[model samples]
Target: MRDFIGRAMMTLYFTVCATLKSGAMIVALRDPTWSWARGISVAADVAALGFLVLIVATTVARLPPVKTAQGIEPRLSALIGCFATVTLIAVPGVQTLPQLELVADLITIVGFTLCIWCLWWLGRSFSITAQARRLVTAGPYQLVRHPLYACEAVVLFGIVLRNPTWAVVAIGAIVICFQCRRIINEEKVLRSAFPEYDAYARATPILIPSISTLRELVFPGAR
Candidate 1:
């Protein structure tokens, strides 16, 4: 019953997210100026909508987890980390655009695209919070243990660039800290569920790949 409720809530959440992104895309497309920024915003919205819909579908079809993170702490950390950056919405918009606005938009586009790509690989294993749905060690997982979070960090950095305020920076730091905690909690859950997880973790970088890791990715034969 709890799983059913959680799944329903997650599905509803992603559905709403997709709907909002769709609306944003339409509004951006209909802009009278139709500037480069407008085009980039529309692109980002489209990418966001793509992943959001995928998330909704996957959440509904996801298999039951072998183990879920116990305790309210893990759940709270994940929830806070996921939604903490929403405070940026309350920050006053700056009229004078920073030189990095375009770059930020471009980063957001790439981030959203990468996120969708990762989500495609994640499929039914996707979950907003920490749970060992399945031991996915393929695709982007081959590069990093938490590719989705890495992609999200990229998107979050872009958001900070778009805002470029001290307040936003502070919020970003807070979000990062919470996200790290969430990762820790997730790692514990995964380790508890899968015996091979420890070996995978030892082999894979936690988030950012090391130089050696990148070299290996580019040259699979390199030892």
Candidate 2:
């Protein structure tokens, strides 16, 4: 029952973020007087919404109903923190929208693509509950250890660049910190549950992609 509730809460959280971001995007795109910041916001919003949908659908489809927990779970707190940080980013700040630049557009496009790739990599392996069921070494995992989070970081960095406000930057930083904490905690759990996880960690980079690692993953015999 606890696990079920946690999963439900997580779903609700992602749904709310997705809805908020989508609404913000619609507003940005439809407004004739949209500023540069507004346009960037619109891109970020769309990317976030699309990512959330992918994450939620993939997660719920593979994971079984979570059993209810008896007490507060650390993962729940981390989840809430993540939600809060993302919400802060979605909210508009005091800065006026900057003028649109070609470089910014290219960055945003790349960021969006990375997020999509991250979601694709995380397919069927995503979960909200505080349990480590399996060590996924296929797909994106074969490329990087935490591709989803890495992609998100890239996307958020692009968003920050588009709207170089202190608020947005701070929010992005907080979100990164939250993700890092979650990653650390999750790694601890995974290491304990799966003995081979440590070995995998030794060979794989956590977030950043390396050409050599990519080669090794793609061509096992080359390494």
In terms of TM-score, which candidate is strongest? 1
Q: Which consecutive 10 residues in model 1 have the weakest lDDT in total?
A: 86-95
lDDT of each: 0.79, 0.65
Candidate 2 lDDT, 100-198, residue by residue in tens? 443444565677677677667656556643456667876777767777677667667666766677777777777787788767666776777778888
Error of 1 at 13 (Å): 1.8
TM-score of each: 0.89, 0.76
Q: Give model 1's TM-score versus the native structure.
A: 0.89
Error of 1 at 46 (Å): 1.4
Q: Which stretches of candidate 2 lie over 4 Å from their true place?
A: 32-44, 65-73, 92-105, 128-130, 215-223
- Estimate candidate 1's alpha-carbon lDDT, on a 0 to 1 scale: 0.79
lDDT of 2: 0.65
RMSD of each: 2.4, 4.0
TM-score of 2: 0.76
lDDT of 1 by residue, 1-223 (tens): 8888988987876676667667667666777886777677566666667767777888899988889988998888887776664334223234447457778778878987898888889988887678888999999898999998899889788878877788788889988998899899899999999999999999999998888878987998898
